[model samples]
Target: MIHFKTLKQANHAFMLLIFILSSLFLSACSGQEQTKQKIPIKDEKTKETAVPLVKEWKMPISISADQGEFYKVIGWLSDQQIFYVTNLKQSSHLYLYNLITGKSKLIYKTENPIVNVQISPSKKYLLIHSSPSSNEGLVTIIDSKGTELLKKTFPSYDLDFEWNPYNESQILVTKFAEDWSFQLNLLDTKDASTTVLHFPEPFIKWINKDEIAYLNWNRNSPSLDAPLSFNGFGTEGEKTVFANIIQFEVYRNMLMTVSANKQDKSMADYSFFDKKLKKLFSFSIPQLSNYSDWLVPFYDYSEGKKQFITFKPLTSGDADTYSEGFQLIRYDLVKGSSEILLGGLENVPLSVSPSGNAALMGNSFEKIIDLNEKKIYDLKRND
Candidate 1:
C-alpha cells in the first residue's frame, strides 16, 4: 500500500516546481519587443517617411540609413544640444548640433578620434582631448567659437578626464595600466606648464577646486567582486565601505558620495553620504537582475531644492528575454525616495541633461532611450 503522507509531500513539491518554472517562463516571454527592423510612418507635411515617436522626441536616430550614414552622437551638452563624433574619409571631426534647430555645425576637426570632450560649467570653453598617436595624449582648450586658446601634452595615456570647475587651470586625468591611477595636474593655460599631484590607486576624484575627495583602495585579501570595499583619503581619511562608488558631488558645505551595493543575489543597495562620512539614506532594488555593467551618476546642485543622483547601469540581453540590461534610477537624497526612471533594456550611458531631468543613452543595437519619458528612441539610421 502507498503511504499517504509521502504521496502528499511529493504533490506539494511538484506544485512548487511548477510555480517557479511558470514565473520564469512568463518573465522570459514578457511583452518587451526587441525589433531592429524599420517601422515607417508617412510625414504629414512633407509626405516623407518618418518613424513614429513613441513619446515626444523619441527615437532620435534615423531608422532607414546605412550604418556609416548615421551620426555617432557622443555627448549631450543639454537637452537641446548634442555633440557628434564621426569620421569623413578617415578624418575625424566633431560637430555640435542644436536639437531645436535640427541643424549641425562643425566644431573641431582633427586627424584622430576625439576620445574625451568636456564643456566648462559656464559653457564658455570646451576641452578636447584626443588619443596619443605619436607622443602623449594632446589636450586642446578652445573657446565656443572654435578658437584654440592653448594646447598641451600630458605624459601618460588617458581614457578618462575631468576639469575642476572652480579652477580652469587644474585638470584631472585617469591613467589606466595594470590598475587605475590618477594624475592631478595643475596647468598654466597660457604657458602650458604642468605640475602633477600624484594620487595612489583609483580613488582620486575631484569634488571642486579647493577640495578633492580621495578613496583608498583595499589591499588586504583583495577581491574585485567583493560585495564591499573600503574608501577614504590618502592613508588617513575616514574609512567607508561601499559596493560601487560612482561619484562625489559637493553642494554648499556638504559633500555627497553616491554608491550602490549588491545586497543579495537579486537585490541591490544604493546609498548617499554627507561630508562627515555619515549616511543620509539608502535605497535598494529587490528584483533587479545581476547582469548589469557600468553605473553612470548624475548630480544636481541647487539650493533649497531636492537634489537627485541618477544611476544608469549598462546591460546586455537577448530578444526573448533580458539577458543583460541597465536601469536608470534617480535618488532624491533629501526625501530619500528612489525612482526607477527607466529600465528593462540594454544601454550605455552617454550623457545627462544639465537640468537633471533627462539623459541620452545608447545600446550596441543603435537604440537610444530617453530616461525622462521612459521611451526608446530608435537611433538606427533610416535614410
Candidate 2:
C-alpha cells in the first residue's frame, strides 16, 4: 500500500510541472504576436517619396581661337549660343558662337568702331552703339538674325542707351552735354515716339515694368553736405524712397544701397530694401574696402528667399592699384549668416550666368566656376 501511494504522488507532480510549462509557452507566443501587431509596415508610397539629388553637368566644349577673334562677350543669347564682338582694324564685328558645334557666324558688322553693345532682356534684339566721329554717335537696333530694325544718330559727345527690361519695344537713351549734364529720353520702337523727362541724372535702372529708380542729388544744400536720394519714377510721377544713398543697384525686386555715414566719412553702411521700400538688413564696411570689393545679388526672391554674393578684399587700397586677392562669400539675408565659397582669388569675376549658377573668373588663365556644384573648369580654347 505504501509503494502505490508514492508512485501516484510522483505522477501528479510531473503532470503539474508540464501544465505550468505549457501555459508559459502559450503566454510567450501571445506576447510575441501582440508586439508584431503594434509594429507598422512600410508601403511602396513611402519608398517612392525620397528626393533625388541635384543634376550635375560638365563644362561645354571650348572654342578654338582660329575660329574668330573675340574681344568682348556681349552675353549669352541662349544656353547654347554666346554673342561676342570682335574689333578689326577698320570695322567691328558681332558674332554668335554655338557652344556645341564650336562654330561662329558673323551677325552684324559696323564700319565705325563699336562703343557699347546692349541686348534686350528677351534676347530677341540687340542695340549696337558706334561712334562715327568724336562728336557723332549712332545707335542701331537689330534683330538676332542680323536684320536692322532702327537706326538713330546723336550729335552729343557722350551717348548711352539701355533697353527696358519689361518692354521689348521701349529703350532709354541718355545724351550728355558738354557741361557734364545729361538728358534722359524714353524711346518707343513700335510707334517711334520719344518722351523727354525732367530728370537730369542718367544713372538710372528699371525697377519693374513701369517704374525706374535713379539718384536725385539735393543741390540746394552745401556741396559737401548734399544728400543723395533714391527716387522712383513711374506713371504716377516721382517718389523719394531713401535719402543719403551714396551708391545703389536694383536686382529684380530688391534694392541694394550704400549710405554715407555722417559721423565717420571713412565708413559706410550697406543696406538692402525690398520692393515696398522696407529695410531688410544693414551692415557696415570701410569706405576704402567698397572700392575693391563687390556686392552681387545671388538668387532671385521668387520663392521668398534673399541671398547675396560678395567679394571681400584681403587688403584694402585703391581699386585700380590693389594687388591683393579677395575672398568670395555668400550671405543669407534670412538666416543672417555667411559662407566662404572661395578664397585667395587673384582676379575678380568677369561675368556671371543669368541663372547665377556659374561665374567666369578673370584670372591669368580664365576659368569658369560652377557656383552650385563648387567646381572649377578651365576656360581655355581647345586646340
Candidate 3:
C-alpha cells in the first residue's frame, strides 16, 4: 500500500511541472508575435513612399594643372552650345561648340587675353573684350556665327561691361582706374558713338536709364578714414546725396548700400526713387579663421527673369585641390537662390537659348552637364 501511494504522488508532481512549462512557452510565442506586428505598422507609411535624389553628370575633363592655374566657364549660349576660354588657349581663344550637331568651331581666336564675353539680350551679338599685353583693351562685337560686327577701343582699361535689357543698342562699359577711380561709358552699337558719364569714384550701379548710384570715401585724420556719403545721378545729370554710407546697389527705383563694414567683406545698397527697387537689402558674410574667398557678380535685375553666373572657388580646403577647379552657379534673380546646375567643368562657358528652354555649356573637358535635368548631354574629345 505504501509503495503505491508514493508512486501516485510522484506522478502528480510530474503532471504539475508539465502544465507550468507549456504555459510559459505559450506566453513567449504570443509576445514575439505582438512585437512583429508592431514593427510593420510603425514603418508602413515609409515602406510605401520614395525619396528623390539629386542627379549629376560626370563632366568630361580631367584637370592636370597645379594650384593657381586660371580656369573658369565664362559663358554659355545654350544647353547645346557653349563658349569657353582658357589661359592655355592661344591668346585665350573663345571656342564655340554645338553638342547636338557635334560641330565645334573657334569663333574668336586672338593673341590678346579676353577678359569677358557676353551675349546680348536679343542673342544676336556676342561682345568679346581683349586686354593686350602692349596695347589698350578693345571690345569686339561679333555675330553668333563668328562674323565681326564692330570693335571699340577704350581710352583706358575697361574692367566691366554690361548690355542693357531694354535697349540692345545701348551698352554700359566701365573704365576702371588705379587707386579706386572709374568712369562709365554708354556705347550705342548702331551708331558706334560713346557717351561718357564721369563718376568721381567707382559706382555701386546704375539703377535705371535715369538714375545712377556711385560711392565716395572720407579722409579722417592722416591714416584713419570713414565713409562720407553716397551720391546719385538723375536723368538730366542731377545729383542727390546720402551721408555716412559705404556700399550700395539699385534695383528698379530702390537703392540699398552698405552703411557699416564692421564684419562683412561686401555689402549692397540701392535706391527708392520714381519706382521702388523691392527686395533690396545688404549684409556682410562672417569669416572663417582669417582666410576667406568672396566672389561678387554684377547684379542684373532689370527684367522679370535675369541671369546670374560666376566662378566661385571652393572655400573648404587647400588651394591645390580647387585652384584648377571651380563651379558655375546661376540664379534666376526673380527666384531667390542659386541651384547647382553644373559641375566637374573647367572654364564654364554658358549660353542660354533665345527661347530659354535650352542652354549650351562648354569646358576644357569634353563633357557638358545639363542644368535643367542634371544629366550629361555632351562628351567632346579633343583630337
Model with the higher lDDT, candidate 1 or 3: 1
- 269-373 per-residue lDDT for model 2 (tens digits): 678888887988776554443342333212222122365666665543465676666667666788887777887775454455555565555532145666667
lDDT of 1 by residue, 228-335 (tens): 233322445444444444444455445555444544533335455565558776655433333333233333443334455354444322223545455666666677
Q: What is the TM-score of each candidate against the true structure?
A: 0.63, 0.68, 0.51
lDDT of each: 0.54, 0.66, 0.53
Residue 383 deviation, candidate 1, in Å?
Answer: 5.8
Off by over 4 Å in 1: 1-71, 132-135, 175-184, 224-267, 276-278, 286-326, 363-372, 379-383
Model 1 poorest ten-residue lDDT run: 33-42
Q: What's model 2's TM-score?
A: 0.68
Using TM-score as the yardstick, the better of models 1 and 3 is 1
lDDT of 2: 0.66
Candidate that beats the other on TM-score, 1 or 2, i.e. the better one: 2
